[model samples]
Each structure stands twice: as C-alpha cells, then as structure tokens.
Target: MRVVRGREFVADRAWGAEDIASMNGVSTRLHWTDQPYKWHVNDGEEVFVVLDGKVEMFFRENGEEASVTLGVGDIFYASVGTEHVAHPVGEARILVVEKEGSV
Candidate 1:
C-alpha cells in the first residue's frame, strides 16, 4: 500500500516515472514531466490520466491530426496503433497504465 503526493513529485528528467505495480504484463506508473513526448504508436492499449497541471494531447486519426487540452482528472485512452504525443502546459504529473516495458 502507498500514497503518492502528485504535486510534490519530481524527477531528474522529463517523463521519469515511479513504478507502482506490474501485473500480467501490465504496469501502472506515475510520471513527472515538463517536456513534450515524441510521437509514437503504442503496441498495446494505454491509459493516460492527468493528475496535476494541464496537457495538450495531440493525436492522428484518419490521416488528420487533432488535439485536446486535458486538465486534472481527465483521462485519455489510447488503443493499440493509436499515434499520439503529449505536451505538458508546464510541469505536470501523470498516471499511466500500459503494457509492461512499453515506451
């Protein structure tokens, strides 16, 4: 059992994460970042939750690019082969659940 203070969490670099659990080839993690992540497609489904600050989530669909601004408590589910990237509005803490060893 554990309690994580999201707002107070810090990482030496962007996207650094604290592993919470791993089960059945899936992992849950808490990530701290202030930088944008590279665009890529996930090999499996991913659950992205904004825990603090804001994020501009960009995704590609049907050969078009679109984006959405996500605030606290917002969730973004990325199905397999979904191409996307995340850019934080500033410093943000995010909780992510996805296949173990996935980038």
Candidate 2:
C-alpha cells in the first residue's frame, strides 16, 4: 500500500510531481490554490482523487460547457483526449494517477 500525506505532499512542487511506479500505474499529486489553471487535453486518461478542499472541473463538448464540484474523497476521471480545466474553490490537494507511458 502507498500512503501519502496531503500537507507533506503540498510542501514541495517537485516532490508532488515525482513519478510513482507501481504495478497498477504511475501516480502523482497536484496541489493547487485558489487561482484558476488553464485547460488541458492529454493522451492518457487520469483519475483525480480530491484529498482536501473543493474544486471545479470544467469541460466543453459540442460547444456546451459542463462542470462539476468535487470535494474530499471525490474522484474525477478525465478521459483521454478530453479537454478540461480544473480550479480550486479553496486550497486543494489532488492525487492524479495515470497508466505508465500514457501521458
């Protein structure tokens, strides 16, 4: 089992970006503040596990905008090639996991 503390993970951006290799997959935690970040579309699918605070995930499809609110323990999946933006409603910490060689 892999265990990580949100407070410790948030302390260093480099540490948060460190690659975790396991039989299941590679995982990384991304920490965000209240500032909004740009949307992104990657080649790999991703599962975002909300560890603290709240976040808004916005996506656009067929010229329509869709969004959802996620809080602690909430998991959000970003499909491969799906364009989306994520912003914290407050201070937030999220663990992002993706398959190796997928990103």
> For each candidate, what TM-score against the reference?
0.97, 0.74
Q: Which stretches of candidate 2 lie over 4 Å from their true place?
A: 12-25, 30-32, 99-103
Top lDDT model: 1
**Best model number under TM-score:** 1
Candidate 2 lDDT at 64 equals 87
RMSD to native for every prediction? 0.7, 3.1
What is the lDDT for 17 in model 1? 95
> What is the C-alpha lDDT profile of model 1 across 25-92, one tens digit per residue?
99999999999999999879999999999999999999999999999999999999899999999999
Each candidate's lDDT (Cα)?
0.95, 0.70
**Candidate 1's TM-score:** 0.97
Model 2 worst lDDT window (10 residues) = 11-20
